[model samples]
Target: MAEVRTVAIVEDDPIIGASLAQRFAIEGITTQWWRSGEEALAGFARHRPQVVVCDIRLPDLDGESLFGRSTRLLGPVPFLFITAFGDIEQAVRLVRAGA
Candidate 1:
């Protein structure tokens, strides 16, 4: 059987984070939900999820920086940014920059 992919979700909103985590759980995928970028970064070394779902507006560290740091640590894993702000320009920039 193929290995199940692990996914890390970095979102400040408890409701959304929990919902996303639950969704992954229902799909039988491993998930780690973090409320802050710092928390995610700290645990990333141990978890090393193949995919990361991050919110752009975090408490201490923003998603852009988090994505960059994650890439540096794990060598460019897939990152899916989620934000209510919905800034297309910024998203384009992030994607162009390899986030």
Candidate 2:
């Protein structure tokens, strides 16, 4: 079977990003952490992660926008989005729209 090569974490919160990275590492998943949407885009140009975990409230671009752009670059990869409790509605909408 083919291995799951990389998991990308796109979060502005340093703590969250580090914590998630550590957890994925423990599971033996190669991870790439991008602090912003722009950084993720640049990285995607080089290598598309097998999975992308992104924060909805990104600094440069929102999660939905990032998801759209990322899909354009690398095609439909699995994406998991995180957001604050207050933004649950938006998150739901995005998910329903296939984020």
TM per model? 0.92, 0.89
lDDT of 1 by residue, 1-99 (tens): 546589999999999999999999999999988899899999898889888999999999989999889898888788999998868899889989887
Model 1 spans with C-alpha error above 4 angstroms = 1-4
How many angstroms is residue 11 displaced in model 2 relative to the true structure, after the best TM-score fit? 0.5
Tens-place lDDT digits, model 2, residues 28-81: 999999999999999999987988999988899988999999988998888998
Which run of 10 residues does model 1 get worst, by summed lDDT? 1-10
The residue-level lDDT of candidate 2 at 68 comes to: 90
Candidate 1 overall lDDT versus native: 0.90
Worst window of 10 by summed lDDT in candidate 2: 83-92
